[model samples]
Target: MTLTVRALRAGVPEDAEAFARTRRATIPYLVCTAEALAWEAAHAPAGQRLHRLLATGPDGTVAGCADTGLLAGSTAPGHGFLHTAVPPGQAGRGAGAALVAAGEAYLAGLGVRRVHSWVADEDGARRFAERLGYRRSRQARFLGLDLRHAPLPELPATLPAGVTLASVADFADDLRPLYEADVECAADEPGDVDVGATPYEVWLRLNWGRPDWDAGLSGVVLVDGRVAAYSVAQTDGVDRYWSGMTGTRRAFRGRGLATLAKLAALRRARAAGYVHAYTGNDATNAPMLAVNRRLGYRVVASEWRHLKAL
Candidate 1:
C-alpha cells in the first residue's frame, strides 16, 4: 500500500470529518470539530506556522493526521509542537511515522529548535513517540464529569463580599476584562513554556469567538462589577461540555471564586442536557486540581507532554 503525506485541503468537509475522526479515535476525551479545526487555521497568530498534515492510504482514504506549528504563547523562540494521530488500528503501518517525520521536517525548515508532542500514557503511544526521539517531559491528567449521572455541586454560598456569580454573556458588549483575566492567570500556570504577550484581538479571535464557546454557560464571578474569576465552557452543542479555562484574577485570591465559577458553569451545563464534562490539568497545578477533585472530577486518562531538541 502506498502511503503519501500531503497538506490538508482547507474548506473540504470530508477532510475535516476525517481529521476529527482520527483525533477522536486517538484522544476521545479531547473535543474537536470541523469548525474548531478551520477556525484554528484562520485565527492562529503570525508566529505560529500552523500546518495540518494528512496521510493517505493506497485507496486515497485519509489514514492519519498531524498538526505542526510553533507555540505562539512560548516566551522563547523556536518552541514548536507536532501532534499526530492515526486512526485506531492504523498505527505502525508507516502512517504515524510518516506524519511525524513530515511534521518534524516542516518545523525544522522554520528553524524550530525544539518540538513537543502529547502522547497518551500508554505503551503503544509512548513507544511510538520514543522511537521518534521524543522523551517524556511533563505529565497531565484528563478528567471527566458524568454530568448526566453525577449531580454537579451547587454554586457556593460563601462568596467574598461584593462578589457575585455571573455569566460571560453578561459582558456581551466588552470582553477585554475576560481576556485580561485569562492572560494574568495563565501566566502563572506550571508548564515547560510560559504563555506571554496576550493581545485583546488575538484572544477575541482564538478564544472568545470559538464555535464551541458558550457564553451563556460560561460562568464568571464578579466583584463590584469587575470580572474577578471565570470558568469558560465549550460544548459540542449535544451532550458534552468542556471547561475551556478557569482562572481567578491576581487580587482576588483566597476567595473560592474559581471553584464557585466552575460549579456554576457545570450546573448550568448539566441543566442544558450535557451528559459529560471534560478538562485537563497539569500535574503540578495543585490549586486547580483540588478544585476539580472537589467537583467530583476523576482522572480518566494521563498524557505525557514529550519534547525533543531538533
Candidate 2:
C-alpha cells in the first residue's frame, strides 16, 4: 500500500470531501463539514503559508489529510501548527506518518521554528507523537452533554442587576463588539498560546463566517446592551452540537453570565434536535470547567498539545 501526499487546492470538490472524510474518521466527536473544509483552505491568511494535503490509497480513496502552516498571529515568527489525521480504520497503513512527514517538511521549508500538533488521549497516538520527537505540553479535555438525558440547568431569574441574556443574532450587523469581547476573554484562557492579539478580519472570516456557526442558537449576556459573556454554538446539521467558544469579558467575571449564556445555548441546542453537545476546555481553566460541570457535562476524552522544535 503505497501512500503519497497531494495538495488540496481550493475549488476542488474531491479535496474538500477528503478533508471532511478524514476529519470525521479521526475526530467524530467534533463538528466537521465540507463547507468548513473549503472555507479554511480558501480563506487562510496569505502570510501564514497554509497548505492542506491529503494522503491517498492505491485506489485513489483518501486515507488521511494534513494541514501545515505558520501561526499567523504568533509573536514568535516561524511557529507552525501541523494537524494531521487519518480515519479510525485507516490507522497503521502509513498514511498518518507520511502526512506528518510531508507537513513537517513543508513547514521546515517555510522556516518554521517549531511545530505543534494535537494528540488524542490514547496510547497509540501518544506513542506516535513521542516517537516523532514531539513533547506533550498542555492537556485539554472534550466534554459531552447528553442533552436528551442530562438535566439542563435553569436560567437565572435575575441578572447581575443590569445584565441580561440575548441572542448573538441580535448583533448580526455588528459582530465587531463580540469579537472584541472574545479577544479580551480569550487572553485569560489557560494555554500555551497568547491569543490576545487576534485580528478582526481574520476572526471575521475564520470564525464568524464558519459554516457550522449558528448565531441564532448562540447566546450572549448583555450588560447595558454591551456583550458581557457569550457562548457560540456550532452544529453539523444533524444531531451533534459543538461549543465553538464560551467566555466572559473581564469586567463581567463573577457575575455568572458565562454560565447563563452556556445554559441558554445548550437549551437551544436540545430544542434543535441535537442529542449530544461537545465542548473542550483547557485543564487549567477552573472557572469554565466548573461552569461546564454545573451544566452536567462529563469528560469524554482528553487531548495533549505536543510541540517539537523543528
lDDT of each: 0.88, 0.88
TM-scores for all candidates: the values are 0.96, 0.95
Q: In model 2, what lDDT does residue 198 have?
A: 72
Error of 1 at 188 (Å): 0.5
lDDT of 2 by residue, 1-310 (tens): 8987898878988778879878878887789888887777777778787898999988988889988898887766778999988888888899888999999999999998889899998999999889989999999999999999988977767656777788889998989999999888877778675544777887888887877899999999899988999999999888989989999998878978889999999999899899989999999889999999999999999999999998
Which candidate leads the pack in lDDT?
1
Clashing pairs in 1: none
| lDDT value, candidate 1, whole model | 0.88
Single out the weakest 10-residue window by summed lDDT for candidate 1: 151-160
Question: lDDT per residue, candidate 1, 1-310, as tens digits?
Answer: 5799999888887887788878878888878888788877777787898999889998988788999999987879999999998877887788989998999999999999999899989999999889889999999999988988885676655766788888999888998888888888888888899878677887888887788899999999999988899999998777878999999998987778899999999999988898889999999889999999999999999999999999
The alpha-carbon lDDT assigned to residue 92 of candidate 2 equals 88
lDDT: worst 10-residue window of model 2: 189-198
